[model samples]
Target chain A: MTFSVEVNGVEHTTEPRPGQCLRTYLRERGCFGVKKGCDSGDCGACTVHVDGVPVHSCLYPAVRAGGHAVTTVEGLATAGELHPVQQRFLDAQGFQCGFCTAGFVMTTAALDEAQLADLPQALKGNLCRCTGYRAISDAVRGVTTVETACPGRAVGASVAAPAGPQVVTGTARYTLDVDVPGVLHMKLLRSPHAHARVVAIDTADALALPGVQAVFTHEDAPRRRFSSGRHENPADDPADTRVLDDVVRHVGQRVAAVVADTEAAAEEGCRRVRVTYEVRPAVTDPEEALRPGAPLVQATGNVVGEVHGEVGDVEAGFAAAAAVYERTFHTPRVQHASLETHGAVGWLEADDSLVVRTSTRSRSSPAARCATCSTCPPSRCGWWRAASGAGSAASRRCSSRTWSRSPCCNCAGRCAWSSPAPSSSSVPPRGTRSPCA
Target chain B: MDLHTVEQWVDARTVDAWRPGDAWLAGGTALFSAPGVHLRRLRDLGGTGWEPLVEDPDGRLEIAATCTVARLAAHPVALFGQCCRAFLASFTIWNMATVGGNLCAALPAGPMIALTTALDGGCLLLAPDGAARTLPVTAFVVGDGRTALREGELLRSVTVGPLPARTAFRQASLSTLGRSAALLIGTRDADGAMTLTITAATPRPHRLRFAVPPTAGELREAVEDEVEHWFDDLHGHPAWRRHLTFRFAEQIREELS
Candidate 1:
């Protein structure tokens, strides 16, 4: 069904099936600053101002945002000026990758100077993997003056004072905010058991659900396995993920997916689908998975691989030390609670190629893999396509080379090109030292 | 998105609209964090408007439940104001969070709970009917994420008596930037009746009262016996929380007496 939404003071009419989120809606309308790190509400990357208040837009329904003023990073700037928050971010070097910067800025903009004092508490919801947050805190505190209107400009540019309201007063637009016409809501039926093998599958009952449009099982999906790894060359790594799989290795592994007219209908379709499984032994602990007796988490065995690099020999260092502090610190598995939950909208173009819009780390390893992998070309890669679609597409290749020369050249750089093949002429000289060195 | 879409009613009528799947949306601080709630409708009771801090017909101080924690901390009263100022860690989010919302949220670490229960504050709940009932703050919270408010009932205000001649408060947390692990507030009335409220360590606020100021040994026993519902979560384990609570209670008792 079609719905009308007012975003950043402009009214736009779009169609979205029930369950369509506001994050996707905003991205489709060209508010590309909203990043999607985690699809769950934990990460504040998708935070936007809905009705002038900062909120994680990933979980909010597009229907819920109807008739509301949605302000995104795009809305933060108006009439060729930078919002004070954005300018402060630039001055403070608050962002490295710039993926989480928009969300951080939007969240900070929502807070007054007094609330900004509690930087750790206010930013607890927004997670940044880079720059360590010292700069972000500075930026939030630096923007003392409140603006009465949006300061319009390209976010990367330095501009004068913001003209908008000081406090973030409404629900913000995020990646899941996109509203597409005739879009179908999709839900994945995850495996309940951590480890199991499918004996038989049936979707006949699920297909009978009134609003169910399509049901995809292992047989209906492409046999090729794709990896969700955020690496530059995925082919160099393992492509272990599949749209649907008969063997479930994890609790949240997708077994089937259903598309329906409404989220409720999709949920019902997922519930109706039945499958017989042969339960198998499972290893939940990372430590046990390394032991010989433990059940393997993957067919390759439980060891996901290890990184062992030493600046100096630890045994010799310990022998030389007067005192050695030996302790094993355990860091628990933490979810990147990005306010905007992960979501993607995919539809077939006129040429029959699938066009998907999602919030993903730009210039990530996976994007590089898409560029190099034969099966999935760079043109089809989501990040590459998105970057190329925007202006200054040619600079992407130049930046990719520059990125490789300085850093590990993984997905962290803005370069859209795939990593050069080992045999390619573009490979840097073997003796050449990296800029970081 | 539209707060105006939800009709606003006065205190009594608003409580009557509460339903199984409905949530009471106050300042939207906690509710906005987890929007996955099943509640389709929210009862916005924040617009009840501000009520004066009154020295009621009885000498007790009546703080409107809708009063923000920032206001409570900034109030002219010495003891209450001191507790409120200490409660202000960087979370000015408390500026908008109402007294009723913090209590209803029922977090053991709620700063307001530490302040109110210490001063012997009682909750004034407006039931689904027009009737009103008052309960001591200690009995109001049953456990973590639980409260004694019946369905369709609303907390209108909190009534606290004039602080006893001597009062003192102490609180500690794991990290400088973390939630409270233990909060202790001690008060000794003019009659020398001493009351110590131990919060954050347990699921519910634990109050230990003595006819007169108790020795450190006597206060420790009362605290150990009264705080049966010890909290053990990611913030802290029960053992540490218990130990810290005991240590702080003793410190508070000595300082207050």
Candidate 2:
């Protein structure tokens, strides 16, 4: 099982388990430049050069690289100078969240003049959820000198990201990249039926597992309801969510949580817990749900509230206007689909106070919400906003302020959190020269 | 969770000792994209060192199962190149995905099926006992996400004969990077015979042959009567697929005639 390979001209030896992929193997060896988005190869977030050819490390077996040479975004730079692709990315400010920047850099660096002619098709694998394709195309085109300089700059003079060099070089650290000591992994068992009531949950089998630290159900957690969405004021939103509930309104709703020594152990523990459910009729369409009698999503009613806006005299304006168009548009409810999914880490400090790190825009809200759910003193809790490449909604209970060396859980409801970057605080030292100010 | 259940990996040079639960690994593009909890071992075939492409004296080209899409598209064949363009896969996917993998996936929206079947291609299959057999590309794919591949069998290569003297292709999609809703390709051989192949709009490629170009009305009736299933999915509706397939088929017949 011993795998010895040359990475960026240095030889390293690793013993990967049978199913360990190359993305995880590289990250364990401090090669954090290779990011893991979708374990599936569709995202291309884990692209690396295997024997001078770009391949998805998430799909490649760690043992497959035993005798081959590998290159990551961290290896793009020579002794002191940045690669032309990296330099152009920095100059054009082509990235926003920068989670997909390393993958883009790896693909763009290998492009030649002939391939540049088909640039759109060439860089299609790397998905930058934040920035549009214009800036990315301009950066790649600038390197080849195939097009003239774009005209017209905005009012303010152009400025590069403060952490642009570090991002391109794969030195910037996101929430998941931060290292914590003696942390336990948590996993949830979700409901398969959209509308159902949990009749009984037997957790005795799950607690018998070897590495499982704790198994929690609705009976053990707090009973207070809280709002999962973000609002200017926490009280402005309706309190329709609890840490765990007996009634499941939608599929994929959390039923119970398992905290264990490793992710594998947690996953295994989740599968062992058995639950009895009473399935109920469900409605999938909005109009159908609003009919005279439909399964209610909430205890109160199917409809929350209606809003009617008027800019002027509607009937008079329509009559006087030359032309008026009316149409009904339906927009599907879709996830923000950030490159990084929601994640958080929490632990008790030496002072016996709780500290939680997460990626969120509502700084004070998480601290306050964590304290309220933990039933601990607000002053004793420490909450730090994660330097997200892009923000995502991490769910309730996950950021709870409970003070324990054991696992504390958080849930990602429908919250979308995006954090703007170029801040120096998020950059980890990777021994690269700073970018031009 | 990750693929934590895989416990064994077998590196095989040939199809001699293949077993059940053994999956062949070429580019690992489609294999890793979806969940494969049933797979216990991956038999690495890229190590076999099969030559990517070869041209026989008869002007037929044999494409190895391990040949990447990018390599196949870069070759000098015009019809093959046009089909490769229909893939619409990124350079990264093009470099890692194999032509054999695409055909074996048997997706209703697969562009490789459209290309190879249009040019009268055949698949070379090798079973675990070292027995080899050949089947036309149209018969190789049985249904969606289903192939005629037997357990422990490996697809060796695909053979594409010389291109037709006159060929034309038409494709339509919902979006710029979306999967093809309907693809209609027509070719006229040197003997003045014509073949029309339709893909993406059906569960399998539907091909129509004629000694000479068929009449416009005949083409429409043949498509409407022969194709029982128009292939319904998220990319396009069955009604839309049928409409577009008929419209494109007539346009190709007119252009070739």
Candidate 3:
């Protein structure tokens, strides 16, 4: 259906699909600041002023926004003048990774002094993945000026992040903001059963879908095993994973992938790519997993490896100590819940070499792993960064593939030049790193 | 993340002539968050033309199905404001989440359920056949995430009577951002009758009344005997909920008395 809305004071008319949401529609229309941290309204990354009221655009239907006035981070600046909130954030050094900055700015800009008292409660919805709330709150509360020690360097000074002004003005770009042309959308068909063996995969139905480009399964991928958790050194973790495996280890594990022209088409293709599974007994408890007769998570064994360390002789240390205490504590598994999910865009170079840009910590490991899985030489693989956090292993387990000719919005291009942090010398490296752009 | 199965959308202004696989779209905060492969078409209620909120001459409030939590909080009804605080939703969520959506979601943690039920609220339901009926808030929710809503029936509005001059509220949760583990609300009627309602910690709201303010022992006995089942989930254990409910109930009684 044709949907028309006024965005950033410009009237935009577009034919949005029935299932399309305002979040995806706005981003597609070059409003890169509206991020999709969580498609659900839990995260306010997609917050925008709809008729002057902040609403999570992810939950708002694109068609429902017809004839409404919308204001995004990009609209905060008028006639090349910065909005007060944007300027305040810049002065306060309000962000670190800057993933959630635009949402916070949008919300804070609409607030008056009356609402500032409940600042914490008002901001409870928008989560910043990197920095603490002190700087952001200070920025919104108009605590702009801070004492600085050094004139040139501002060493140990509470200055704004290099990316602050761009972030607040809604011009900064993250991985998802990249406008890649003719990008193929990829979706995975995850296993529902925790422990199961893929008996058969019938892809004929999925392949029949109109826009389906490729349906990949274990048969299509290399049999080489590598750890999904990539460390600086490849030998640090167990090499126990393949690109696709016949044996599903746990629920939500990808068994097959569908690449199609559109996200909806890819998802429909994923749903259609049905596989027959032989369900096996699953072990959920860690103690049960260590039992002698427990089901093996890996073919080698459930126990990957063990490390034992001692600073001093245990018996001697205990005898010398007045008291000895030992307690077994259980720590739950944690995902590196970065505001921006892990994603990668890859396409073959003109010379047939593959180049990949991804949201990951280790730069070279993805290329090495991809080369290992695709039977390509390491020299033929190139790597780039898409944006990552300090410590998050969640993206390590899953690889987000952005295909060639996709809409690539290289955020680095916009910020790399005007970045306020004095490290302009690193700009040349980014230029060489982002080959696909 | 994409809604793959939704092929059709009907901008419904009315609740008539509903078809299969059709669902009402209110604020859509919960509906969009959930896996809705089963939903083929959405009947948009945004154009229903219902006033967000209204206060009749009788001092009773009529909250429209599309009324957002933020709007309801802005209303002068202080009791509702207290309940709105219990929602624990962010300003973004509050601006988007609706009162009817929370109640109709039938989640045990829904604060609207506790508020409306405790205040003797009634839901105005409109069936597909054009029949309309009013059901108390307590009878509307059958179980966790399950409501007594009939097929193709829509919640038009919820009417709540004037709040008691003397009212007390107490809520307990595992964490600041966590769902309510137990909620106790006490009210004193104009006639000096007392009503105690317990929610969140239970599968549904539990209510008890007395001609006069009951003693701590009487309140405790009534809660232990009447509250046959305590809602069990990750929010809190049933035992912990029962204990908290007992303690909070006493605090409410004392505060209201």
Our model 2 lands, by Cα RMSD against the true structure, at 5.8
**Top DockQ: which candidate number?**
3
Q: Individual DockQ of the candidates?
A: 0.14, 0.48, 0.64
B121-207 per-residue lDDT for model 1 (tens digits): 898887766689999988787778788899877788888887578887777778764678888888888898988888888888878
Q: Residue by residue across B26-64, what tens digits does model 3's lDDT show?
A: 888887776688878888888888999788998888989
| Candidate maximizing TM-score | 3
Per-candidate clash tally: 57, 8, 14
Ranking under lDDT, best-scoring first? 3, 2, 1
lDDT of 2 at A173: 69
Candidate 2 CAPRI classification by DockQ:
acceptable
Which is superior by TM-score, 1 or 3? 3
Model 3 residue B134 lDDT score: 92
Q: Please give the CA lDDT of all the candidate structures.
A: 0.61, 0.74, 0.75
lDDT at A377, model 1: 53
User: What lDDT tens digits, residue by residue, belong to model 2 across residues A1-437?
Assistant: 46698888889986766666788778877787788777677667788999888988887777778898999999889988999889888777777777788988898888778778987667767788777767788788763322323457534555566778778888876655655444566778888899899899999889899887777777765677766553557766676666677888778777887777767677779889999999989887889999988988887988766789999799999999999999999998765666765666665545655555655555567666655554556787665555465544432223322111223334321110100110012232222222211
What's the C-alpha lDDT at position B6 in model 2?
Answer: 62
Off by over 4 Å in 3: A144-160, A389-437, B14-16
Model 1, A1-437: lDDT tens digits are 34678887889888533334566667667665666555445556777887887766664545556667898887888786788777777656565445577778888888866557767766766777655787677667674322234466455554322211221211223323444565666666778899999887799989898878777677654466655442444444466644466788878666776767766677778888998999999988887887788997668776655788878788999999999999999987553332333344444334423233333334444344334422345455443122111112212222221111111112211111211211111211122111111
TM-score for the A-chain in each candidate structure: 0.59, 0.85, 0.87
